[model samples]
Target: MDTILYPLEWFVAFVMVGFHKIFSTIGLNAESGWTWALSIVGLVVVLRILLIPLFVKQIKSSRRLQLIQPEMQKIQAKYKGKKILSPARSRPRK
Candidate 1:
C-alpha cells in the first residue's frame, strides 16, 4: 500500500513546488513557500479533525485493553500447563 501511495505523495509534493514557482513568476503572494506549507499543514489539520472520532475510539479501546490485562494474564496462567507439551508429543499424527 505504501509502495503505491509513495509516488502519489511525491506527485503532490512536486505539484506544490511547481505551483509555488508558477505563483512566484506571476508576482503573487503564493510565491511564499509558507502558502504551500500552510496549505499542507491545514490539510493535515483537517484530516486529523476528521479522524478525531477514530482516535478517541482507539484510546478508549486501549484503555479497556489495559484494564483487562490482569484478567488476561490470569487466563494465560490458567492455560500455561496445557501449553507446555513434550517436544515428541507435540508433533502431529498426520
Candidate 2:
C-alpha cells in the first residue's frame, strides 16, 4: 500500500512545502507553528478548488440518474420474472 501511495504522498508533500515557501516569503515566521498549520490549510483550500469541477460533475450525474429512476423502475417491472437466455440458447427469429 505504501508503494502504491508513494506518488500521492510525494505530491502532498510538494504542495505543503510549496505553500510553506510562499507563506514564508510573505513574512510569516518560518519557525512558527502557525506557518506550518496555515500551509496545511492552504493545501486543503487548493485541493478543494481543484476538485470543484469533479464535484459538480458528480452532482449533475446523480441528478440525471435520479430523474431517470422512474423509467428504470418501469423497465425493471416490464422485465420482471422473465428469464434472460443467451443468444446461443435462443431460437433464431423469422
Candidate 3:
C-alpha cells in the first residue's frame, strides 16, 4: 500500500512546494504558517480547476442516462417474466 501511495505522496508534496514558491515570490513570508496554509489551499484550488472538465462530463453523462431512464424501464418491463434461454438450455436434447 505504501508503495502505491509513494508516487501520489510525492506529487502532493511537489504541488504544495510549487505553490509555496509562487507565494514566496509574490512577497508572502517564506516562513509564515499562513503562507504554508495558503499553499495547501492553492493546491486544493488547482486540483479542483483541473477536475472541472471531468466533473462537467460526468454531469452531462448523468443527465443523458436520466433522460433515457424511462426507455430503459419500458424495455425492462417488456422483457419482464420472459424466459431467456441460455446456450446450454437451447441445445437439442440428446
List model 2 lDDT by residue over 4-93, tens digit each.
Answer: 999989989999999999999999999999999999999999899999999999999999999999999999999999999998879887
The list of candidate 1 runs beyond 4 A from truth reads 1-28, 84-94
For model 3, give the 10-residue run with minimal summed lDDT. Answer: 42-51
Tens digit of per-residue lDDT, candidate 1, span 1-94? 9998998788667766666666556675864766677556655665578889999999999999999999999999898868678888999888
Tens digits of lDDT, candidate 3, 1-94: 9999999899899999999999999999999998999999998998899999999999999999999999999999999999999999999998
State the lDDT at 85 in candidate 2: 100
* lDDT score of residue 11 within candidate 1: 62
TM-score of 3: 0.73
**lDDT per model, in order?**
0.76, 0.96, 0.96
Model 2, residue 20: C-alpha shift (Å): 0.7
Each candidate structure's count of clashing pairs = 0, 0, 0
Can you give the TM-score per candidate against the true fold? 0.56, 0.73, 0.73
User: Candidate 3, which segments miss by more than 4 Å at Cα?
Assistant: 76-94
